[model samples]
Target chain A: MKRIVLLVAAVFAATMPAASAAGPVDITFLHAMPGPLGQALKQIVDGFNATQQEVRVRAEFAGNYDQLLQKTMAQLAAGQRPDLAQLEVSLVPRLAAGGHLLPLNPLLNMGNWQDFWPVFRRQATLASIGGTVWSIPFNNSDPVLYYNRSMFDEARIATPPATWDALLEAARGLTQPGRVTGLGLILSDIWILEGTIWSAGGEVLSDDGQHLLLDSPEALRAVDYWARAVREGTARVYPDIQSWQADFAAGRVAMGFGSIVSWRFLQPQIRFPLSVARMPYISRPAVPVGGANLAIFKDIAADQRQATWQFVEWLTEPAQQARWAGLTGYLPVRRSATTNPQYAPLLNLPATPSLKVGIDQLPFARPRPTAPGYVQVQVEMRNMLEQILLQGADPRGVVRQTVERANRILAEEATR
Target chain B: MRKARPVQDTLVLLVTAVFAAPLVWMVLTAVKSQADVYMGPLWPRSVHLENFRLAWETAPFGRYFLNSLVVASVTTASVLLTSILAAYAFARLRFAGRDWLFLLALGTLMVPGEVLLVPNFVTVKRLGWLDTYAALVVPFAASAFGIFVLRQTFRKLPVELEEAMFVDGASPWTVLWRLYVPVTLTSAAAAAIFVFLGAWNALVWPLVVTGSTAMRTVQVGLASLIYDQGYNLPVLMAAATLVALPVLLVYFAFQRLVVEAALQSGLKS
Candidate 1:
């Protein structure tokens, strides 16, 4: 079968006519949104194009965030930069380290910079990069607790757990032998783990941003809290995020932690009642933001730069963001968009799992660690958790080792 | 040996099941509704053929198919042409450092394609071919794999065959097109098939080079369904099944030739 791959000659004209330069200041945008999400983004871009005549934005889907970064860097190296790039937040620090990102502060003259969700602003900013925001938050989301409402009722629970201790207890009660595992733990993203650490009054990174504090007493406590549930047979670690969502939709797991955006993928498959609530905290209520950001290159034409900024600004405006949030379940980067008339329907959206809780928890939202090497470090943190929860390894020992490895990576990144 | 036949047959069935499981699963998922996808019976209790229609409607897949068809076809043709010429010269023609140059061409295969991705992309951009078919087809036009296969095939041919052609007043070009190429049909076909497949399945390079939807390919469209949220497994599976159909048909039709041609390349080497 592999041998016969595309053997015959294609008679159709292969050469696509290059985009003409005669349009209204044609500019390119590289993004990572896919499927309906890409459609939503395209719709918004189309609206912007329809309403304007000075500049035309051509948005391109460049695989995913990692792929987008590669394309952006390659194009930047060739001095053929895309007008805009949608980058994941952690990627901003590494890209800014390349010194090719146009620091957004100078281009963003609008007063709406402050109107963006503070979490998003902080998420897209790097103090080490001259305290400048390198990217603007676009498709931002924070983790929330997703649970089976039917199982909670069956367990005779009155409300979803509000604290870490209560969550563990609920997991213990919700467990029906040979039926439902209480919680399905996602071992991919460190945002949930970081949020948990913060809720335990511990920080994932130090104030100086020089080290990971995962080995700190509070952080270790947070790790142990989840690991304890796993050891008790009330929870199980899912190999990946998709599997966790699938299990929850299948009613195999009573509870799980996922982003506000997960509902769009899970709601169509769910058969039982579901509920979303604030991320349960060990000590206090806090959540870490996760999602992609929009950035621009440093060396675009002056007119193109202004035009690109105008498009970027238009994309993040309250009205467009509200529509984007409605079409796609991504949280709007701007606070004003949540209160926009279009966003009101989603807050009380008719579904077993509504994502309004993610917005409700925004006041306590914080940014994840965004060091140049943090992307690599996240793998270590996730691995450590997977070991503890899935393999019954001792949490304290794993935490110490993971923190040491993380700091070493950060040190190497700093020197580079 | 005769008594062990049943055990071997059982083993073969197990291996076949292992290989066929995913393909079977994909077909089932394509027909299953969203409700059945997450939790229902392994063999779907109900089938929805409209799932394919829904998957097709979700995005501009028809446009993607056209792009992929054009890109793959143009690329495969170019690769075969270039490889035949290069391989013929390397195999039959006398030149200084002949073996060394062939070795140098072959050494390119040793470097991971990913390592060359950035430099190649930069070069393509500088050449002002970005978003054109040339950017997609030209860079992959001359593959070391294709050259190696054809060269091996050409080298294995008795020298008297080419000498006999030249004795009959055939030019090197005629000897190549009329004599060498047809005589080496099996290996060349193998090389063409392999080259076409690479061009067809490519995602990252094509995604980076082309910017507009009109230039997008099926693989890119498939990749777009897979985002941070997760796959709509049924729709994604349906689209994948649709994408696999033409290739499956081609493979089944050329099954014996593909195997024979592949064997020819390996045996000559």
Candidate 2:
């Protein structure tokens, strides 16, 4: 029996590293960036570690937002909570509802909190979370128009369209009879849909976030605008992002909509002169802000909370944000980060594709609806898009039915 | 044997092509340049083999390969050990509720592995096995599928041989390992392949369990290449092709043995 105990002890000793001598307080950060993006994130964390001696931050890649959310929930269930978590904007509502988030209002100073882009500040303090800032914006982005310059020139258009109606007019002129498609329609991405509905002055959810407002006349107009373009053979819909991007790069389409960060991937393959602009609005300029935010969970060890907040504050600083944006192509959360010396290279990157437009569009951005039930409601939205765009169903009746079904799904979730 | 007809042959070829298309695309994309992947012809105008080099350098693929090889090999061996002993006890040993226990053991097969993920993670964490090889290998050290396959193979053997050996003053261990193992080698190989592949291609459980770069597997390395929003297609394809090569080689080397064992041994009771 003693021999068996010794053997088990030996195995454990061999597997686990020795406990470190007491020094700096260590806090774990769970983030959703992987690949080269993850490596860039590492630099920010390493930069913080180098600047201070009180706290040591260890960051780990938790896959994408969906995967990171799953791992976070599992960790929470296991009582193995990380000190900090970077969650997607749409998912923050769900986390806030879980009651595990430490409301960030108390830890933040007014000046630091106020320095974020106005759109991001609005996004951070969503109504669904009781108007308290549950998370601070981190790697921010906004979808914009990336177009072929030669196609617009050949069509005798001097400037890209500034509104949805104008875009249709431009598409009519730019689309060649049997050759070039005007727009690469992306209906499946709920972010683009959110921007379109908001631009048309329609709400996806009500003020209280208890009911669906997608059946409004304004939302129907947004859907109808795209339907008209597709029916005229000026627009083509691809099944997924990669296929659409491939076709766009191949010059099959005159213009496409993608997040500003995707420029890093798309620009490398474009063999023609390209242009970037804000997402054309219907009534007024509005876009859906993309990317994740950092939050301190309520379950963190009390002593570790201060250290974690310090890490968050440091990451959002202009210098750190500038360095991060320059390395990863994620938009800096702070408006001041754009003009920092570190950001100069990105602004002047040889043949740089509109570095200022992403920052300029920050004031007009809105996050996807922050209702906890909207995640489940997204499935119904996808079905609505498929029906209207591909099946040619009337947006009026389809929109109403989608709202009814989505409300039922949301109601079921609310009860659960 | 029935002679092949043109329609049937064409149908078979079409089905084979359907299965082979993605693999062919993976290899073609792995060799092509980034621009070629988007706009070039079906075949590359110029093969840029440097994509493989880029993929290899993107991560510490050497460490990843070693970790994966060790985990898969050790897990496969442990599973075979537990499965053989479990099968023999149920097939030959006389005990209370032996058949009932065997039925209950097979009952575990009805539960999907995903349902057990959280509970397994909690258990491993409590055991201080996180970020360790034991965490990767120990929970999967025994598989119900492995036991079922080996048990079925064992039951197919003539029971009279064991009985006769026992009467002649031979021990059960000698009869089992020395006699049964030699004849059922192909069946054992079949079980080993499934266990090996499962351990090799694992993603979520392994990703959650192990956090350190030193302990990561090759699948995690491939996943890391697919970053935010957009990934480089040729580079991703190159990494995927490298990750899949070992499994393809293993399957090819063991194909005839598993096929013969499945055919020559009566698969049905």
The collision pairs in model 2 are: none
Candidate 2 structure quality by residue, lDDT tens digits, A282-358:
99888888678898899787769989988888887887877787787777888777756666764343333544677
Worst lDDT run of 10 residues, candidate 2 chain A, spans: A346-355
Candidate 1 TM-score, true structure as reference = 0.91
RMSD of 2: 6.0
> In model 2, how large is the Cα lDDT of residue A290?
68
**lDDT (10s digit) by residue, model 1, range A109-199:** 6677778777877776678778887988888888888888888888899998999999999999999868889988888867888999999
Estimate the TM-score of every prediction. Answer: 0.91, 0.91
